[model samples]
Target: MRAVLFAFALLLAPSAPVLAQALPYHIDPGAREIVPSLAAVPSIRFLTTADFPPFNFRDDKGELVGFNVDLARALCADLAITCTVQAWPWDQAARALEDRQGDALIAGLALTPQNGALFDFSQIYLMLPGRFVTPVAAASGFEPASLDGKRVAVRRGSTHAEFIRRYLPTAGLIQFDSEIMALDALSKGEADAYFGDAMRASFWLNEHVGCCEFAGEPYFRPDLFGDGLAVAVPAGADAVRQVIDYGLARLKRSGAYDELYLRWFPVSFY
Candidate 1:
């Protein structure tokens, strides 16, 4: 059955790109058929971390909830799939998908090459800038290049860690399990500054970390951050991957993607 479905998917794949570009609202015929089977496959789990709020986080009731969760649910609904959301430790989520413990990663993961080699990414659904956040007193006087010998906190296995390790090799790097913890380290003066996705950094600084403020202009590295966040599938899951990409294109053209983005983010971008 899987082979037959996959073969059908291949037959439909040739027209996907053209359809994605021409029609504002289109769904791959092949994907529509496979959608029903998704529910029966208990192996088709969605992986995410429980601590990353506003993106993917656990609510007070211990139910997984947030932007990524909602997006994942919506995507599954569009695909007519029953997707089970599971909380994997942050560092293990991607690995879980790679090992086939899960089918997809809906964690709003940035598309870095190192990751790209292991997984296929859906179309970029959201874009976020990276920023430097420091104590208010230190914000005005800080410079990215000046952190030569200072300690900087970044979430473990994050793009921030990738950036700092590559760009600020001379600086001390402290890897934390969560952004909240990294901010806490900064507040306690254990680290000179913390860096992360600008929107998340701003949200955290405004609501929780009052001691720090964002410094430096926001910039995104295509090499390190890629275009934006996407759902990642294990490499070679072409049929499932094509379905997701097609669904994403449909969502974008039909304005469903915009509506969802506005519902959660509100800020508009052309």
Candidate 2:
């Protein structure tokens, strides 16, 4: 997710242009648009980092594994071309891709405005949310503005941190160095609430009883998260982009996407 001192989570790097505090969680199904040249592209080199789990990471056997890897394989199959999933260090990813070392990048990276000038990204397939987590008793029905004097905890310097400062300014902010620390603050009553990734919060709450529960709507903002995760390709690589779009569509249509999603993300972000 958004994991960095300067992380913008998948936007790890913008999430929302404005606060979309409430909206139905549905992505309309559509036909895949294909670029004829994608069929002619003999191979696709998928560049990704191995640190983002559930999306991209190395398994116990040291093999690259995760949603991105599976998707890359599926997209290659859709295009009827070979694809190699190569893991790269985070710092070198941009340079490597720009130098023509790889055809695409899919390490849970966001489609930021800055990235728009360097590469084109496929349609966003997944969007993580900024959520509020509070003790079950304290998780009363509330909205962002309702946290008038609540002390909220957050990972220091995360997109969610920024979201709270900008949107929930009335709530006091308690910054932690790590997610565990922030969550602990809520569990221990050191903080009245915790703001962060909805999916992660779901999984954590499900695992740790009496720890916390969802307190409000999941926030969706392009300026807050960047537009979710998409395949990044060389600029003008229309064929490659289209192929991925088509494959993702087929995956959704046939229920393969749901299956993979459950396999990796047992908890839903939405």
Residue pairs in clash, model 1: none
**Candidate 1 residue runs with Cα over 4 Å from true position:** 1-44, 130-198, 201-220, 224-226, 268-270
Q: What is candidate 1's local distance difference test score? A: 0.68
User: In candidate 2, which residue ranges exceed 4 Å CA deviation?
Assistant: 1-28, 33-38, 77-81, 138-140
For TM-score, the strongest prediction is 2
lDDT of 2: 0.73
What's the true lDDT of residue 52 in model 2? 73
Instruction: Report, for every candidate in turn, its global Cα lDDT versus the true structure.
Output: 0.68, 0.73
lDDT of 1 by residue, 149-210 (tens): 99999989988898998889998999998777887898889999898766556445545435
Which RMSD values do the candidates have, in order? Answer: 12.8, 6.5
For residues 1-270, write the lDDT of model 2, one tens digit per residue.
424312211222112132322322233355354335654578889999877765777766888887778878876776578889999988898778878899889987667678889998887878877888888876787667767998989988899999888877888999998766888788888998889877666556645656667786677777776567788888898777777777777777766776666555444456
